[model samples]
Structure formats: C-alpha cells, structure tokens
Target chain A: EPEVTQTPSHQVTQMGQEVILHCVPISNHLYFYWYRQILGQKVEFLVSFYNNEISEKSEIFDDQFSVERPDGSNFTLKIRSTKLEDSAMYFCASSEGTGRGGRPGELFFGEGSRLTVL
Target chain B: AQKVTQAQTEISVVEKEDVTLDCVYETRDTTYYLFWYKQPPSGELVFLIRRNSFDEQNEISGRYSWNFQKSTSSFNFTITASQVVDSAVYFCALSDFNRDDKIIFGKGTRLHILP
Candidate 1:
C-alpha cells in the first residue's frame, strides 16, 4: 500500500538552531498535517495544510514554526529556532478527503521523525 | 473544546488473555469522529479503526472488537486471545467535523503482553 514517508528518522540539534523535517505524503492525498508528541505525553496537533496554505494551527505552532509545500510532493516543517521543549517525535499525516460526520476521513501517518534539541 | 482521555496508563496481560483499553472523550460537536491507533515497539503508528458519531454500531474484526457508546461518550477497544505481537501503545483520538484542526490524541495506553 502507498504510505507517507518522512526523512531524517532522528535529528539532534542545539538550542536556538534551525531544523527542517521533510515528508512526502501520499500522492493523491489532499489534506496534510503535522503533529508532535513529547516524551510521555499525548500527541499534539501542530498544523494542517491544504491548498498550499495552512488551514489551522494550534498555540504550540507559534511564529517560530512554519510549513511549506515547496514542491508538489514535498511538505516540510521548519523551526527557525529550536527550543529544548521542541524535542519530540514529529508525525506527518495525510488524508484524501473529509467526509461527513458519519464517514469522516482517515489519516495515514508516517513512521515519524524524532527530534532531539540539546 | 475537544479532548480525548485514555485513563489506563499501562496494562499487562499474559499471552491468550483478553484485554480492554478504555477511552473517553469530550466534544461539543454533534458530528465528530473517534479513532484508535496502535504503536508497536518499532515506534510506528498503525491505524486500527475509525468510528463516526452517527454510527454507534459495535464492530468486530477477527479478535479485535470496538465498542462505541454515544450515551457515555466512550469508545473502547478489546483484544481477545492477545498475542505477544499485540504489545504496544494504543491511542484513542477525537476530531470534530466542525473545525479544521487535526485529530487530538489522548495519552496512550501501553500494553505489554507477556509470554
């Protein structure tokens, strides 16, 4: 089956440094999202992207965070200045369409990229 | 506000034992969705099941079954005759159709199936 793929299975960066995580969503998917999970914490939604723009974002997705679909296939998340709290596992997910409440769309998630900030 | 709660932090069961993971959610949207994902030791999340607000019908797939109770706002998963391969973290999630925000995951329940 086709699956979402993420680059840099693991990354370690110093505080105040920049880090970019890449993901290639399923070719036919129309909606993309970024989520993070701190160690021993629940997964938190970061942002959702559709039609080349962010559809929604959480408080955790502040100015320092940005997402881009530079190319048709590549979706990237960039943290301008990483903080220690940024250390977590970032997941990339995508869905083809959002159906009604009776048949909501299901997301396909990538393995995840583990980010470590020192 | 939409929130998902997985009260059981961790659960252990011997091989062949049946186990249930509890999940409760709070959502104001009349139209919403609930989901379950499994994270194996390899740290990869696998989608297990998705239940929408309109469908309260319980479903069973092989040894895995899901109970969706709209009255209590709870969606629970049960694994029967569990095997060693079933050891992993299971997460219950909620999403509102009225909003563009992504699914919200609860603190996962780590399941350890001892041999």
Candidate 2:
C-alpha cells in the first residue's frame, strides 16, 4: 500500500534553534495536515494545508511555526526557534478530499518524527 | 469544539481474553466523522476504522468490532481472543464534515496483551 513518509525519525536540537521536518504524502491525496503529541499526551492538531496554503491552524501553531508544500511531493514544517516544550512526536497525514466515493475524512499518517529540544 | 475522550489510560489482558476500549466524543456539528487508529511501539499510526455520524451500525471484522452510538456520542472498539500482537496505543479521533481538514484525537488507551 502507498503510505505517507516522514524524514528524520528522531532529532535533537538545542533551545532557540531552527528545525524542519519533512514529509512526502501519498501522491494522489489533496489535503495534508500536521499533528503533534507530547510524550504521553493526546495528539494535537497543528495545521492543515491544501491548495498550497494553510486551511486551518490551532493556537499551538503560533508565529514560530510554518508549513510549506515546497514541491509536488514534499511537505515541510519549520519551527523558527525550538523550545523545551516543543519536544514531541510530529505526525504528517494526508487524505483524499472530502466526500469522495463514500470514504470521507480518512487520513493516512506517517510513522512520525520525534523531535527533542534541550 | 470537537473532542475525543479515551478514558482508559492503560489496560492489560491475558492472551485469548476479550478486551474493549472505551471512547467518548463531543461534537456540536450534526454531520461529523469518528475514527480509530492504532499505534504500535514502532510508532506509526495505522488507520483502523471510520464511522460517519449518520451510520450508527455496529461493524465486525474478524476479531475486531466497532460500536458507534450517536445517541451517547460514543465510538468503542473491541478485540476478541486478543493476542500479543494486539498490544498497542489506540486513539479515537473526530472531525467535522464541514471542516474536514483537521482531526482531533484522544489521549489514547495503551493495550498490553500479556502472554
């Protein structure tokens, strides 16, 4: 089966450093998203991207966070300055657009990139 | 506001035991969707099932079954004759049909099937 893939299975960075996580979504999907989970907490929605722009974002996705579909296949998330609280597992997901052929809102998630900020 | 609540933090069951994971969700939208995902120790979110609000049907697939109740706003999953391979963190998620871009997930229930 085709799957979403994320790079940098694990990353460690110092506070105030820049970090970027990469993801390659399933080729035919039209909607993409980013979510994060603190070590032992629930997964939190960060942002959603479609049509080369952000569709929606949460409070957790503040000024420091940015997402880009730099190319047809690559979707990237960049954090300008990482903080200790930023340590978490970031997941990239994609889905076929809404209400297509009875399958609606089903997202395929990547293995996740674990970010550790010290 | 949409929220998914997986009240059971962790559960341990002996092999061959049947286990059920509880999930309660809150959503104001009349049209919405609920989902379940499994994350093994290897750390990948595997899609299990998706149920729309209109369909309150109970579905069974082999040893796995899902009960979706719109009246109580709950979507629960059950595993019969569980095996060690069933050990994983299970997450229940929700998304509004109108705003289908992002999904809200629960804290997840960690299942440990002991041999």
Candidate 3:
C-alpha cells in the first residue's frame, strides 16, 4: 500500500539551531498533520493543515514551529530555534476526506523522524 | 476539551490467551470516531480499527474485535487466542469529524505476550 514518507529518519542538532523536518504525504490525500512523541511519552498533536491553511494547532505547536507545503509533495515542519524539549520523534499523517463528520476520513501516518537535540 | 485515556499501562499474557485492552475517552464533540492502532518496537504506528459515532455495531476481524459504547464513552478491543506476535503498544484514538483535523491518541497500553 502507498504510505507517507519522511526524510532524515533521524536528526541530531545543537540547541538553538534550526531544523527542517520533511515529509511527503500520501498522494491523493487532502489533509496533513504533524505530531511528536518524546521518549516513552504519549504522541502530542502539533498542527493540522488542509487547503493551504492551518486548520488547527495545539499549544505544543508554539511560534517556534511552522509547517508549509512548499511544493506539491513536500510538507515541511521547521523549528526556528530548537530546545532540549524539542527532541522527539515527529510523525506526519495524511487523510482522504473532503467535507465534514460522521467518520468521513481516516488518517495514515509516516514512520516518523527522530530528532535529538543536544 | 478532548482527552483519550487508556488506564492499563501494561498487560502480559501467555500465548493463546485471550486479552482485552480497556480504553475510555472524554470528548466534547458528541459526533466523533474512535480508532485503535498498534505500535511495535520499530516505532511505527499501525492502524487497526475505526468506529464511527453513529455505528454502535460491534465488529470482529480475524482475531480482533472492538466494542463501542456511546453511553460509557468506551471503546475496548479484544484479541482471541493471542499469539506472541501480538505483543505491541496499543493506542486508542479519537477524532471529531471536522474533516480536516488530526486524530488524538491516548497514552498507549503496552502488551507483552510470552511464548
């Protein structure tokens, strides 16, 4: 089955540095999302994007985090300044749905990008 | 506010045993969908099942079954004759049908099956 793909399966960067995590969602999907999980922690929602605008976001997705679909296939999440708390495995997910409710969409997730900040 | 809770942090069973994982969720959206996923040691999230708000019908697929109760806000999963391969972290997720939002996950329940 076709699946979402993420680049740099693992990333290590210095604190206060900028890092851009890349993801290519499944083709023909309309919605995309970013989530992160610290070691042995629950996966936390970051942001959701649809139709070129951010549909919704969580507090974990603060000003330091931004997402853009710069191209047709690339969905990138950039952290302007990384912190120790930013170290986690980031996952990208996509879904196929157009309008509203009643179980219209199901999300498929990527393998995830492991980020380690020192 | 929406929160998905899986109280059982870890469960262990022998091979060929039947096990059930409990998941209770709290969501303001009366209309939503419930999902179950498995994450193995590889850190990959595997989709297992999805149940809509309107559908209270219980479903059974292979060795897996799900019980969706709107009254209790609980969606529980069962594995019959579980095997060693069934060992993994199971997560319960909820998604309000806004069409463009992401699914929120509960703290996963880790299952360990001994051979």
* DockQ list for all candidates: 0.63, 0.79, 0.61
lDDT tens digits, residues B25-108, model 1?
Answer: 999899888999998888767889888899999999999999999999999999999999999999999988655347889999
CAPRI class of candidate 2: medium
Better of 1 and 3 by DockQ: 1
Best by TM-score: 2
Better model by lDDT: candidate 1 vs candidate 2: 2
Q: In model 1, how large is the Cα lDDT of residue B59?
A: 99
lDDT values, one for every candidate? 0.91, 0.93, 0.89
Give lDDT for model 3.
Answer: 0.89
lDDT of candidate 1 at residue B34, scale 0 to 100: 91
What is the lDDT, from 0 to 100, of the residue B12 in candidate 3? 100
Location of the lowest summed lDDT over 10 successive residues in candidate 2 chain A: A97-106
The residue pairs that clash in candidate 3, if any, are none
Per DockQ, what order, best first?
Answer: 2, 1, 3
TM-score of 2: 0.97
* Best model per lDDT: 2
What is candidate 3's CA lDDT for residue B100? 31
Window of ten residues with lowest summed lDDT in model 1 chain A: A97-106
Residue-level lDDT tens digits of model 2 in B35-68:
8999999988988998888999999999999999
Which docking category, incorrect, acceptable, medium or high, applies to candidate 1?
medium
Cα interface RMSD of each candidate: 1.8, 1.1, 2.1
